[model samples]
Structures are given as C-alpha cells and as structure tokens.
Target: MGSLQTNELTLSYGKEPIISDLNLSVPEGKITVFIGSNGSGKSTILRSLARLLKPERGSVLLDGHEILKLSTKEVAKKLAILPQSPESPEGLTVYQLVKQGRYPHQSWLKQWSKEDEEAVKHALRATSMTDFHDRPVDALSGGQRQRAWIAMTLAQGTDTILLDEPTTYLDLSHQIDVLDLLFSLNRVEKRTIVMVLHDLNLACRYADHMVAVHDRNIYSQGAPEDIVTKKMVEDVFGLSCDIHMDPIFGTPLCVPHGKGRQLLKEKKFTEKQRKATLVPE
Candidate 1:
C-alpha cells in the first residue's frame, strides 16, 4: 500500500493560483478518481501530487516525507505519472518507448537485468499491447496508443500511479477497458491508482474514492454514495439533477435536468398537454 497526502496544497503557474488550499488523502491500494468541470483544477492537483508542478504553498507528502524535497530519481522510484497530454517521440517503437520507463531503476554500471525484462513483459501484457510491442507507436490506433502509454507507466513499477485524463480520445468501450484494467491493477496487484476523469458516471462507477473539485478547490470527496447528491451537482456544476443508483455499478449516478433544444413538434405537444387540450384539426 502507498499513501499520498496533501496539506493545504496551493499551486500557481504565474500570478494566479490554479489550485488553492487543498487537503486530500488518497487511500492506498484503491482507485481514486478526481472529477470536475473543465478548468476546475483537477489536472493541476494531479500534476502537483506527481511533483510535475511546484506548489507555491503547502506540501505534498509521499509516505510522510515531503515529495518536493526528494531527488527526481527517488520520486520516480515511488511514483509515476502519465500527464493529460504525453508526447511521443517520432519513430519510437513500442518496445523502445516502454523501455524508457526503466530509466530510474537503472545504474550506469548495471543497466539491464532479468527483473527489468520481466517487468516490461508484464506491463505490455497487462495493457494488452504485447502484439504491438515491435510496431512504431504512431502507427497504432488511438485507443491502442493509449494502452501503450499506460503500459509504459506500468513498467515504471511504482507503488503509486497518477494518470491525468487517461481516457481522453477513447470511445466508450475503450474507456471502460482502460478503467477496468486500472481497477484490476489496484485490487489484484495492490497498486495505488489515481486519475482525473471528465465523466462523472465513469468516476462513480469505477472509483473507490472520489474528489470533486470546483473553483480551484475540492468541493466534495469520499465514497460516491456518501459524497454525491442532487444539491452537490447543482452547486458545483450549476445544474439541477437527481442522484440515482447506477443499475450496473450500484453507485450514485448523476442525472441532470435543465433547458436544452428540442424538436418544435415535441414542444408543441408539451404545450398542448399542459393545457389539457387537443391540437386543432
């Protein structure tokens, strides 16, 4: 189990703080998902926890030690992050790309080991990308490429894995595939999984822990059933909704009700029904 906590974490890129005064604890060996509207600081918090972004105030601690003070290699050994937008070097084969994850584990004198080979193999198989290991990454489909990237992070073999919007560009089926893979890793492999997600339903479905961020701070967090409510959605998302139990997952499922475009015939029928009168023949 790997424990990560933030103490009043505040981060800013320039003059303005992207995230402010945030305190969060991620339970070890579980899937924790962060959810919010765009620009709600979900990515910012993930980046800070991964030590990709420096917090202007507060601190992020990994297992009770200040993470920012640790050396880059030391931090890499304990945690791995796949950012919202990870770059792929041109012409890099899948095997070569995943091999880079081993950088932190290697010493100049002891570059490769039997253990490293096994790790790479396990990671590729876990992501179901073993078939494409020799293919250039750019040649794969969008979903396949995502799986490859995830494989690389898995190959890093850290106790804590942080992923920022890992499902971006994936279709519904592929989205579930990735989330399911991570869920298994958490439950079976006992790895810590943390990710940012745009889909509230997906978050509620897969997350053992959930954090809702709004206006640069965490608005609510905890088990989905405990934290998600109609009022909470209205308050954070500025939308009215009924919170219902998801039929498949038995978690709180958010259903929004508000104004939107509808067919003119449908609108006319609604008006006619409201007046309890039939339309003129």
Candidate 2:
C-alpha cells in the first residue's frame, strides 16, 4: 500500500495563504474524507496532497519520498487525481478518454500492449462504462460523465486515488451512487481513497477517516463518530445542529437548526388556556 502525507505544508494563491502549517496523514487502504464549509481550505489541502498544487512551503511525501522529486510518470503510476470539475475535449469518446490513463505506462516502443488493453477494459467495467464506451463524453449525463472520469482514474492502476468533490453538480441519487462506487473500489481493490465532500452527513457515512478543516488547519480528525459533534459543527460551519446516529449506518447525522414549523411553546399561551388544555389531558 502507498502512503501520502504532508509535512508542515503551506499553500497559497498569490500572497494569501489558504492552508498553513498543515500536517496530515492519509491512512493506506482506507477512505478518507476532508470536510469543511466553503472557503475553509479543505479542497486546497487535498490538491496539495495530490501534487496538483505545489506547497509554498514544506513538502508532500508519497511513500516516504518528496512528491516533487519524483518523475511525473512515476507519480502517476502510484497516485491518480481527479479534480473538482474536469472537462474533456469536445466529441471525445469514453474509450478514448479512458485510454489516456495508460499514458504513464506507455513508452515509445511499447505504445500498445496486452496489459494496457486489460487495464482499460477493467476500468470501464469497474465504472460501469463498458456499455457507453462509444458515447461522446459531452453527450453523457452528469452522473455518467463523472463515472467516465473515474474510469480514467481507475485505469491509471494507482494504489492511491485523490478526488476533489467527485459528486459535485450531481443529484442526490447520483451522489450516493458515485460514493457507493468509490466505496466498492476501496473495499474490493484496497485502493487508498481520499476525497473532499461538502455534505457532512454523507462524509460521515462514507468515510473511514474524517478530517475537518478550519481556519487554515485541520481542526479535528478521526472516525466520524468521534470527531463530529454539535459543537464542532457550530464552531466549524457556523451552523447550529443536533447530532444523531444514522439509523442505517450508525454514523453521525447532522440535523441542522433553522426556522421551520416547530412545536409551539406552552409559555406562549395564556395561563388559563394552558391549565384548561392540561386538565383534560
């Protein structure tokens, strides 16, 4: 299993740092989800981990070596990243898109091989895109397009996969479907999966390890049952909520507080009315 870790990492855009002095470890063969409110730097940290963004300071380590020092092809073989909203070329077929994942393993003299063919086929089957291999990428629905992208990532045959908001712009059913697929990959293939998720409940449900980012650093990290609390939700997301166990999964479920039809308070009624109502009951 491959390991990914950050050592005193700092990431910035221009002069302003988005994540500073963040040290994190992604457990091998586990699904880790980074969660936070918008602009809290969850995705920024994930991008840095995947070497998509160079850290302004410190280093990202893959298997105990600095990721920047590794050759691009070598890194690609060990790790694959799917960005937040990836766009493919116009009229590109799904098979063409997935075949690109084999680029890292190909050489001038070994452009096409049985191994490459097997990888692409497995990737397509894994993502359930085998039936849509001939379809244009732009012609597919949102969920299907996302699955196609994931197939490309799977074809890379990396032990570690990093995804930034893979479920973005997807409907509820699609989001669940995508998450289930990733979960299957992790369970069946033992891939190290790391992703950023906006939905706290879903994050808790799907993550084997949950990281909460706040104020440019990791606020808390552990199993969701241990890390997610009403206080943590209020402090990190600025939302008041009740935390409860998910009936089906036994995970933390956040029930946010907002203005809605709530039970009326007895104090709002006249004393005589309250007494009359209580007397009959």
Supply the TM-score for candidate 1: 0.91
For model 2, how does the per-residue alpha-carbon lDDT over 35-125 read when each residue is reduced to its tens digit? 9999999888887887789999999999999999999999999999999899999999999999999999999887889999999999999
Q: How high is the CA lDDT of each candidate model?
A: 0.88, 0.93
Residue-level error in angstroms, candidate 2, position 144: 0.8
lDDT score at residue 155, model 2, on the 0-100 scale: 97
Report the error of model 2 at residue 215, Å: 0.5
Q: Which ten residues in a row have the lowest lDDT in candidate 1?
A: 257-266
TM-scores of the candidates are 0.91, 0.92
**Which regions of candidate 2 are displaced past 4 Å?**
260-281
Candidate 2 TM-score versus the reference: 0.92
lDDT accuracy of residue 80 in candidate 2: 97
